[model samples]
Target: MIKSMDEFTLTINGKQIETKETIGVINPATEEIVGHAPVASKNDLDLAVKAARSAFPKWASRSFEERSELILQFANAISENQKELASLLTLEQGKPLSFAEREINMAVYWLKESANHRLSTEVLEESETTYIEKHYTPLGVVGAIVPWNFPVLLAMFKIPLALLSGNTLIVKPSPYTPLTTLKIGEIASTIFPDGVYNTLSGDDALGPMITGHPGIDKVSFTGSTATGKKIMESAAKNLKRVTLELGGNDAAIILPDVSIDEVIQPIFWGMFLNSGQVCINAKRIFVHHDIYDKFVDKLIEYAKTVRVGNGLEPASQLGPVQNLVQYKKVKNLIKEAKQNGLKFAFEGEAPRSGYFIPVTIVDNPPENARVVTEEAFGPIVPLLKYQSYEEVIERANRSQYGLGGSIWGKDIELAKSIADKLETGTVWINEIGALSPTIPFGGHKQSGYGIEGSVEGLKEYTNTKIIRINKR
Candidate 1:
């Protein structure tokens, strides 16, 4: 019996709320119905938003110190339930048990750190008789749309930051992975004021409701580019501020001088971590011709050694793709790549059942090929060969999506110079997609608008009010 979630009930206004209809939560590894969560109705969404608007005054009126204390309290609550949270995340998210634990720890760290991260006041002018103060103040209710890939971490990314900035939030977690987020709502219910932190679990309607709702002062979303554009359109109806972290076809370039042994693990993890479902995972690897064949050979050999299976199994190094839709997407892309004459560097096998796909390396697919251009967001990655560093630099920057990219070489200065030329939001010299709460993370170009992480993200939850004063 799945008993963790009060049998998958919704949390709203600090209560276990449910609707007549319910949704089944699935475990991707076993293809089993893990539990059932309430399907929120349109009425439920309205009530939640109304409650958030009602709670906004109290939450936003609190001093920064008071807000930080509440945030710390919420962080403590999560820390106290770390084991339970991590276990539930592993079951719903399809990440290995250990990875889930690390994610949980990361969430805890971000939450605690965000509590103490104070936004600095911007002083435009100050004198003995006159002073100008410019700073951010709270938005009413932030609608946070979370993706399934890293539900908890992403939710934590928005929730603590939003709350610390004195804004209440209404979270709509991806239907594919709502149980863990629903549980997070339950945890918040114990710490936040009623309606301060609410979660609505449903299918299609939930997103539109939150984005289009007049009560939502801003929207912080993480998902695909298509959906992000749609969200922007919806939020435009009310001119709600939006911060979107959308799709990424991140490129990782390997220079001629790097040793295969040193770059192998970081490169593999950059491409394959979270089974390549990561938004900033190095989806395309461009290698210099000097070591193209040599790197492919070593990468394939390393790819074979990665274990894939059920997340609960400690031995499992990589987990399933998380859902059927993504599974079919990966499979179709691989099939297309195979037909396009793209050859695999490593051929790892997976069981017929479940959503598991082994790490697949496609060697030298043309830049225009589907597998090369599109974001597979799976274990399959394409390695392209480049003749010159300048050519690879141009190719890496030639993408609609530019969330992140990397340059790997023994000479840190040379790699940094190369990375400086990439058009992504973040570039790593010897790493790919290394994130920190202290630094901001966002994308360039069509990857979407606005930023997350750091004080810049906290400011996203607020509107700046400028006041100028002079003695008469």
Candidate 2:
């Protein structure tokens, strides 16, 4: 088991390279420096890029069968080290230890599933005299910029797809959660060829350099829309292929027909899972007027059961925000909501120490309130009342983000019909947010571009080539 405070270094060409400068990674639950991760220098990045460039040809030449075995081997390594990996993850990212375990298991599952997905050469046209074949080829070096929330799983979302599709990659873990992310490269090095996968942990500058680097052929990022735009602008200089999974203010609508008891747990967890830190978390909820009061009452009644505290505690259902910046953001929003005279259906108070914030739920506030319009990215979620399906759908689509949304009702057909109109990447009917390796997931608008977790996702890492042959 790898301990939390153990020293970490950048991985380049299968080696752990020491750096002159290092950044202290903190345990957000305690706001204490858990350990320092080595920051890669400009020269270090050059060496990493050169290594990937050198390895791409040989690595990409391997057949899908060979690559799939390698990915499964990687999954085996993860299973062997899961206990230590989960501990390190919970220590850094502030989710419960159980959640960290689930994340690790899900990552391994994703690797196995992703390995099973591969493309076959398509016959575009064939005749007695002529034939044309369409197939995908690797795009060389890929730079993956991962966010702090669900660091391990999100990395799995991209890493396997990138590698299995024959592209070499450098994964840049967020400075806030670098421990588990860097360790992936360490485990991967034992089986993967040198530089086929590398991990770099550093401050903000590191991301820009990777996006702007000429040798990096593709960039897959999961973060905020603001940063995604900056990544687009930077990547434009090199014309690098970029696929971004960004911020979301996903809306969940409740219809009058649903049984409150049956749906309450899914909805509650949907809203507050990982303390509401998920990109696809149901951030804004719109309930029909017929059931608004009853639904809110039931929601508050259920929410009273959640206990927020340090993630290491066995019963800690909710953990602290992953960093001070996000903690303060949630704090300020709560202050603003109170000052604006918004009524609270559920009353609660946050703890004083660490990055802890209560599981806050803001009642329907004015539409212009920051809590209503912005991505809280924390425990606070706003509940809005709606009069009609058309109005609710319109309101849900009013956000700048279109990452994911959900509609709930007893009538599955009706709920699915309503879900079809939502302007988001993935929509759930009578359900909330659920991801599968077979599902193609991404955003519709400002949620960023491109797809992940499907054949389309794998295709993003490769370019299509057509070959024509004629009988003489």
Candidate 3:
């Protein structure tokens, strides 16, 4: 057990508030007590809101260049402290160290990219008498609720952009992965003025206080579809501006032209990265009927080589699921699928520990099976067969989730054609879960509304204002 002092607490109004009640942080790999963090009370949340509200005016009034410079500095600080941040992520969330490092790097990239995105001021010159120009202003006191999976990266997706757009933030990190966010707040204290950025860490109860609070001007949430619904309902009390990035049961379609061997590795990495805990991971695989069997056999062959163990182990390619709740959810889904007559195939002998679910593939799974329909959110892949391009597109769009999808084929035109038909916010041709800071990221339908990343993401935290002047 990795026990330490529970000195880490809420960062409200620019200072850490020491609390009497402590929440134990556990490492899933060994079920060890990694550390502890303070459980914030209602009063703590109030302080954070007041602080954000207080800082909003000065932050909103700053020039875009000034805000951009601070984001660049924060990015630099993140890169400089990469090791420490990555280690904390692994300790708290149990993803492989290398994966954690990659997430941190991505977070840095997001911060820098969001900061550098051009903020142009264009004047509309129409015959002098009636001239109108549009400019962006900050939304006051943004409330951000980030998930445990990819905690640092998700948090950066909101924090840097919100700050760059000149909004003060009252952030609530997932109770499971609050450590890194708390560390982020500590770093921001040195770079940002009081209340420009604040973090409150606690359980689900804290979410309502932050989202429902009248003081908060906007709310951004990333989590399950159910919770996202609740957040929307609560924010309605204030008619608060809200953006949600919820659940995704993304699909990947393989056409006859693509070689099985060529695409297997990329697909495996996409599905199993971060233990398949990603919102956009390939949860279902639809292969062309002609190549379906061969693809499945090759996928199993490659999955056997993967190593699963503690996150810190250099050779461990897959780590334990983030927490016991997710572990149980994955286990039950697999069991329920098997009960419904689906056959499970694995690359290696399943681990002795119940928490370490192997890289499992369900062959010829029924369309309605839990493995195929629900977001497994684990290293589980359900293989289904499709006869024609039309059938693949039809099945892919059948889900309520329109988060992400991928099409694989030798003909780029064919792939693009099918990609267009698949209902999703992001679609990759011959690839899966490929995301970059330059592109906007989000989902449609139940996957949640609104966008994140790129210049569009910065706008979510901003309000467009029209100012008119009269010429005498």
Q: Residues 1-472, candidate 1, lDDT per residue (tens digit)?
A: 1236446677778787868998777888989887777888878988888888899899888888998998888778778777877888888878999999888888888898878778767899888888898989988889899999999888878888899998888888899889878887887888889989999999878898888888788999999999999999998887999999999999998989998888898899999999999999999999999898899888877888889989999889999999999999999998887887787777687766789999888879888989888999999998999998789988998889989998888888888888889898999888777788889999999997998989888888888999999954
The residue-by-residue lDDT of candidate 2 on 184-236, one tens digit each, is: 77888888999898889899889999999999999999999999999999989
Off by over 4 Å in 3: 1-6, 347-351, 470-472
Distance (Å) between predicted and true CA of 167, model 1? 0.6
Count backbone clashes in candidate 1: 0
Please, what are the lDDT tens digits per residue for candidate 3 over residues 132-191?
677888889999999999899988878877888888998888888888888877777768
Q: Which scores higher on lDDT, 2 or 3?
A: 2
Best by TM-score: 2
* For every candidate, C-alpha RMSD to the true structure in Å: 1.7, 1.3, 2.3
Error of 1 at 323 (Å): 1.0
TM-score of 3: 0.96
Model 1 spans > 4 angstroms off: 1-3
Better of 2 and 3 by TM-score: 2
**Clashing residue pairs in candidate 1 (N, C-alpha, C atoms within 3 angstroms):** none
> How many residue pairs clash in each candidate at the backbone level?
0, 0, 0
List lDDT for all candidates, in order.
Answer: 0.87, 0.90, 0.84
